[model samples]
Target: MGLFVHGDVGTAASYEPPYTLSSGESVRGGERRLWDNGAACGRRYRLRCLSGSNRPCKDGTVDVTVVDYCRKSPCPSTILLSTSAFSAISKSPSAKINAEYIQ
Candidate 1:
C-alpha cells in the first residue's frame, strides 16, 4: 500500500523534506508522509497498516501528511511515501500491506 517516494530512498546528506505540496501546502522534514488513490495532495490523514499473515508489521499506526500525488500513468503505484516515513511504520518498503485511512 506504500512505496518510497522517488529521490527519497534511504537518508540523504542534505535531508530536505518537501516544503510545499503539489496542492500548495507547506510541509516539513521528518513528518509522516502518504499518498492516496485520488492523487490528492496537501491533505492529512491517519493511516493504519494491519499486520499481515506472513510478515509482521511495524508502527501499525501513523499520522501522515500528504505532500504529493501518486500517478497511475507512466509508473503505476499508489501511496508514495518518504523513506523515513515508510520506515517508521512498515517493516519493509516492498511489502504489500492492508491499510486504513482516516482524515
Candidate 2:
C-alpha cells in the first residue's frame, strides 16, 4: 500500500552483488532492492495492503528487506519500496493505499 518505486537508486550499497533476501530468496535486482525505512540495513518486515479507494496490491501481503534509508527532507511516507517488491504486491505501482507492517 502507498507504494512507490526506487528504480532510480539502481542498487543498494550496503550489500554486495547477488543481494539475497532475509528469506534466503533472490529475484532480479534483489541485491539492489529494499524497503526504505530509517531502520538499519538488512532489516526485514511483512507488509499487507489494506483495501481502500485505490487497490494497492494484488496480493494481500509480502515480505520485504530493508536495504536503504529514506531520508527525504519532506518524506512522502515512512516506507519506500523497491520497484520489484512494489510490483509484486501492488496492482498499480503508483497508487497510495492503506498498509500495515510487522517487523
Candidate 3:
C-alpha cells in the first residue's frame, strides 16, 4: 500500500506504548486498518519499497515499531514511516511510493 513518511518525529500514539523504544530505532504511525483500536502500538513491521515509475525502491527493508496512530485528515496512507525508516527503503524521499510489509 501507499506509504507516508513522517518528519523528525512520529504522530501521537493513542495508546501510549508500554515498552521503551531503543535509541535510533525507527518507528511508524498507522491508519485505522492497522490501528486495531490502539492495539497496534508497539507492534513492529518490516517494510521494503516497491519498484515504481521513478525507480523509488531501495535494495533492502526497514524494520520499525508502531509508535502511534496516523491522525491526518482522510488518513493519507496505510502507514506513516519515520524519516529514517523511509530513507532506508526508498530512493525518493518525498514521493509517495508503494511498499511491501510484514508484521
Question: Which 10 consecutive residues of model 1 have the lowest summed lDDT?
Answer: 7-16
Q: Each model's C-alpha lDDT? A: 0.44, 0.48, 0.61
Top-TM-score candidate index: 3
Q: Encode model 3's per-residue lDDT on 15-78: one tens digit a residue.
A: 2234346654445455687778888887777777665557877787677887666667666567
The clash number for model 1 is 0
Across residues 29-91, which tens digit of lDDT does each residue of candidate 2 receive? Answer: 222223423334666666665553554547655667665544454444445665566555567
Q: For model 1, how does the per-residue alpha-carbon lDDT over 1-103 read when each residue is reduced to its tens digit? A: 4532332222111112543444322222222233334354556655555554456467555555665443324222234445455555667766545555555
State each candidate's clash count: 0, 2, 0
lDDT of 3 at 32: 80
Q: Return the TM-score for each candidate structure.
A: 0.51, 0.56, 0.72
> How many pairs of residues in model 2 come into backbone collision?
2
As a TM-score, model 3 comes out at 0.72
Q: Which ten residues in a row have the lowest lDDT in candidate 3?
A: 7-16
Which candidate model has the greater lDDT, 1 or 2?
2
